[model samples]
Target chain A: MTIVDPIIFNAFLNESKEAVESLEADLVKLESDLENKNLINSVFRSLHTIKGNASFLDLDNITTVAHEAETLLDEVRSGKRKINQTSIDLVYSVVDVLQEMLEDPEMAQAIKSVNVLKVEESKIEHIVSLVHELELLRYSMEKLPAQLEGERGDISEGLFNLELATSKASRITSELGAIVFGARLVPVNNVFRRFPRIVRELAKKLDKKIELKVLNGSAKLDKSIVEAIADPMTHLIRNAVDHGVESPENRQAKGKKQQGTITLNSFVDGNLVVIEIKDDGKGMDPDLILYQAAEKGIIFRGKENTMSDSEKLGLIFAPGFSTAEQVTDISGRGVGMDVVKSNINKLKGMVQIESTLGIGTTIQLRFPFSVVVASCLYVYIDEVCYAIPLSQMEESIHIAKGELFTQSPQRLKSGEEAMAVYSLQELLTGKFQIKQGIKELPAVRVRRKDGRLIALIVDEFSIMEEAVIHSVDSYISSIPGIQGGVIRRDGLVSIALSIDSLLETTFKKIPLAYAVNKERKHPEITDLQKLIEDAREITDGVLDFKLS
Target chain B: MRIYRRELFIFDIGGVPLALRMEDVEYILPASEITSVPKTAQFVLGLAAVRGKIMSVIDGGLRLRIQRQGTSYFVVCHVRGNTTAVLINRPLEAKNLSVKKIESSDVERILARHKLNPKMFSAAWEILKKKDSHWSETGRKFLEINTDQFVSDQMASKIIVG
Candidate 1:
């Protein structure tokens, strides 16, 4: 409703986690007392409650696995089958997958898809199969006829339970998925090893096997980032597998290997950690993309329809721009290429494609390893002061009143013909009341896009120490000009302002509030401003010199 | 529960000065100790380290826009519940003010002379306002600090932080 406030949601999620953990502990104890149907019922009830809570949160994937796990546990509780390892392990794996999926990459999509119900289906089947297998074995052992028996029936039942228990143990192991989740993981050389099994399974399903490879992984990505990159990487690889790699028959026909190959490589370079997904398959056809763009009305078909290949290729990032007519239900409609691009951008990274018609495609992605620390720049505009990241800043310059040229309502050109100036008032709405007699045009310019191309004009700029950033919940997340508020050195809160956003807010709203002598406001020493009148009177004879 | 206020420091503002309760002040450092934080609001002094942790030091005088005649000491006060710091000129003394009920009118009048918005003044300002003014509604002869606002929650309530 309100982006489901994370604080309360976090608390709720924590409670559910506790409930699941307690159930786990109880189930472990129940493992020994197979005939204790009462214990089985109690465990079933707890899992049922946890599943209900997850469903209420619309975490259906979790709900499904949990529901299935609960169903089989219900059978055990109903005395249809004795409690054993298979059932317990199924429940454990369900819980593990639920936890892992809670932080899964495909979660956002799954939340919207009907197939979200499918995640629990397999897990449920796994548990049911275990229960069914154990029941059959136990029933068969009991049916064993005469003499030769000895304690064979009992031993056979014990064997069935043990097999069931093995599965249960592994399911519990799957919960260790938590260990590799989101931010919790510290990947090593071995981390790359885990991907092959997944790739192989997926390849087998697609009826193709690619020699998947993992390159240098000496650098460890905080689990969350790794998780963040997972889906984007998956989409890219899937595209490479389906569209990039040719089938074995085709590959052989083309004088290439019958077994197509795709390589997944990752390493750290400069300030960025690079992840490149390359495949030796047919590359994307730029001409086809241009034709699709024209057909979709993304770009007008004009006399210049004979556009450069690069211009045509850029169409891949246009919204709703798709090259495929029928959705393959695979790596997007070639539609979400824009999404992949933008998502990587959100990570403060860039993605580029290097592909030729028959040659393989290489998608190179580079991201700032970790913005763990940022140099903050503090600026004051009228009464409101805010912080800017020095990481994005280039320089600050002072301008005289006459320096600003008003070309249009929302635009101010500062002698440099191209620079756009944003007034402080427009930056943060209702932040300060600019009235009579404030002097001096105090402004700072921050470099944007590239240092050479654009500059953002702001109220002021200077650098400060780095601190752990705490952002406000979404209720007040997008305050005009404010990116997030941070605790300052003096224990007073200073807002972290988005210079670009602030500028945009200014331009979008007024677009035409032309300034008159924009820089004439010099530092006015008023004897009576509400915030400082008392100190002024007491120090009537004192001289206040400015700090440089 | 006993609320231990941090160590207090004394400083002057104008010719008349006051002390800030130590619990509020995070650190006291030389003027030279302050570093420049770019693009910050004017009141911010810069960054400084107290004990081992680095913190932002604000110019309380600049924060309140308090004026003074000479070189001043920096008192970094932690904003309630937030890590932000507010810098103030040195406090003159640290004296505990007991809670008392008084008319808000008295505060308004007292602050009028200093050109302070009576809204921001402490109970101390109210007492001075009543004594200096002719208003009889200000009630009680002496002034009391709204303890909850002035100091800590262990005492009484009604002090507001905005």
Candidate 2:
């Protein structure tokens, strides 16, 4: 092993580890249907591959365990021995040893200590002989049924016609296609199952009376997408308990139930899967979030009053923005939500937060069915090509370059109230490189699900086509505005820009303060101020004290 | 004791002869159609697709701060399973040499002899600090490149600061 090339060893380790994990899963499934030939064959193949690779590498320990497991499975397959509970346990023991060896190969020399593999040869031979005798007896008994069927005569005349066969073949092919598609889909419960235990343990640890309710656990998503979302989902659940839910006494005083509830609901909406994590507790207060964002320099001071309630809620997803009064070991060093947002964006998903004061907060995440295939609108930014996922792009319009420089951009026909235009090249590279004296420019009017609209200026726009986007290395994907890259049919990779990341980063920066006249003209602010004053009078300055 | 003999793929970057252990070298191809990725470290030229894998091309001249002539080829090497391409002036030779592993304790002495700061060889220092046995071997004391450390160091120093 010391002589082995590290690269080859790593590749082998990865492949063998995956095979072993699948084998573990299949072995449990095999217990229910030990007689299923296809499943038994699959299990056999997994073990054989591991053994062969291990033997090639001269990994004596892994090879020995896998080979022993393979020999036992061969006995079951050959009908020399039956796959009873005892034999299944034997195979499981082998898998356990193999797993330990894979995690630390240096433990291989201790393989001699694995006493289960040293089963007595005479005991195994006796069981095989007993099973062989029973098989022979059963075969003799089954021959009587065949003799009875022989008297029924040939029924194959009209049953096997060309038309029927052709239709059956077509049906089988379609069924096979369905099976293949479904193979990539797994139930949402695969991830949801872990949450109940997590919530229970966390509730006990935090001394909070919180109940987690998971609805629609049977909803399905692509296996890859489901795996990708597991961490974010866990983070949200933790956040709900640690930060969202009020303590029991606090909840009682607030005229709520003593125990809080966190609900995880997943369902399919059109071509996308929607997963919502809703917590019934003290909701996210926009003003407090705004103050935190201001304090962190994520947003300019005094700009908090300018943003709407929903816009302030969006600030929680800004990097290093946390509303927790104190950092806890569990989830809130200010890095939680932004990471969740980025992971969701990497899945090409959208996140929407809806909260009411003292009511609750629900964070809704929507992901497309497949992360690999996407419909992207390809455009050229300074003659370099880039891709924007069509899910984020609402439309493309031809606008004068001067329009982009205006303080106020025209609203789109989609009826979004506020629209801002920015040069895509400037947003990406931090420098404007548009050629001198350019007049008309192509722009993409992109809107996130949360209803923030921005038009990005580009040199030219091209066709909107679905392309397979491959995720790049983290060194590149970790860049502020990049989601992944798409390998074009020409075998060149074009970067797929993340509209969510660009919007989020852009929104966090200081914006030019509104004109004095415009501030007075907006009625909403006056109404909100009046409401705040009314609340202040009713609460006798308590709200003022908290804000101060 | 058996002498560990390995092949070193020697190549030129900015007129300096450097060699990477041949086992890490995946391929060498003509440098063409390199797309520039914006907002990345200056050392990173861009991404190029070769055989369906996107490889980040690093400008060896910029990375090593060496003035170089025209880059003729991309020396593609694997760093922890990810392929990265480094521009080279030209192909030199593949030489088989006997390499002797230097202990971590001797690293400071070697750097002192070369009058190099530990920060200058920060990646090698990190490996030694971690007590990793896979040291950059001494084969005639010619600069033997550990592709993993070299590329990762470029990523850490250049990308993070930029």
Pick by lDDT: which candidate is best?
2
Query: Model 2, A131-216: lDDT tens per residue?
Result: 56556545544444444455433335323333333333333333333334445666676677557656755776888898777766
Candidate 2 deviant stretches above 4 angstroms: A1-371, A401-416, A436-438, A448-450, A508-548, B1-4, B99-142, B152-154, B157-162
Q: Candidate 1 lDDT, tens digit per residue, A1-548? A: 22444544454454565556556545655655667767677767767877887777776667788788888887776668666778776776776676576556554433342210112354455446656756665565454432134344465666555544443433333322212221232343323443443455456666775777665554445545655766667667767776787777777788988777777776433234467788888777888887778887888888236677666776787888865545676655756778888887776678878778877888887664322223576776544556665544555555544444344423433543344444554345433233333333455555443342233334455456543233322212233444444445343455555565455444344321123233343233322233223333443233222111
Docking quality tier of model 2: incorrect
Model 1 - which docking category?
incorrect
The TM-score leader among the candidates is 2
Task: For all candidates, state DockQ relative to the true structure.
Answer: 0.01, 0.12
* Residue lDDT tens for model 1, B1-162: 122222334456554334455576655543434444433555545554333223445555553445655665555455544233344444455444322334467555545544553333343421112235433232322221111232223211321221
Tell me the number of clashing residue pairs for each predicted model.
48, 0
Backbone clash pairs for candidate 2 read none
Q: Residue B21 lDDT in model 2?
A: 78
